[model samples]
Target: MTDDADESSTSLLPEPLRTVTPLTGSHRDESMDVIGWGIFLGLVVLLLPLLPFILIVWLISKVTESLTPS
Candidate 1:
């Protein structure tokens, strides 16, 4: 039997979740390492200062959550 999906059924997916988009990668010598590290370091720089604050808030919330009767 042929394995083929219905085109109308595929259209039910949201735009971002759809696989119909074309592969338009950059036409340059851009290594994936450069892109990966750029995103990783960018997030670190943005979130480093907030990490301690987030941890403290999370700890407090977890403690409160545990103390509350189930």
Candidate 2:
């Protein structure tokens, strides 16, 4: 009964892995910076066409508000 209790209290991990060091950095690759910028620029390029549409909608709303009675 005591042996069963002792076994249950013991750790499941191996002895070497019982202690672990804290992480200080992700060690990301330098080339990844270019990829990140590329993705950001690609999103900007995709959204550029929508910018004109958004401006048109905003202008139409302003014109409608000005024409409405107070």
Candidate 3:
């Protein structure tokens, strides 16, 4: 059937995402900026998820410390 032929032809086609250019020259400088931002962003993202847990733990310790008589 023509449907089978079309499927086969489409399967043989290369994906369009293979045309990536390597970083070089000023592009390399821009890439380093991007990498720096990426790392910073990753750290912020990681911290955000832990922030609430950290705050809760701090609050619990403070409350317990106040309640405990010396």
Tens-place lDDT digits, model 2, residues 1-70:
9999899889486666543867678687879999999999999999999999999999999999999999
Say which candidate scores most in TM-score: 2
What's the CA error at residue 57 for candidate 1, in Å? 1.5
lDDT of 3 by residue, 1-70 (tens): 9999889988866767755787566435787899999999999998999999999999999999999998
lDDT of 3: 0.89
Better of 1 and 3 by lDDT: 3
Count steric clashes of candidate 3: 0
Listing every candidate in turn, what is its Cα RMSD in Å to the true structure after a full C-alpha superposition?
Answer: 14.7, 4.5, 9.4
The best candidate in terms of lDDT: 2
lDDT of 1 by residue, 1-70 (tens): 1234566555666666656878888686568779998999999999999999999999999999999999
RMSD of 1: 14.7
Tell how far residue 42 is off in model 3, in angstroms: 1.0
* lDDT of model 2 at position 43: 100
Off by over 4 Å in 3: 1-30
TM-score per candidate, in order?
Answer: 0.49, 0.56, 0.49
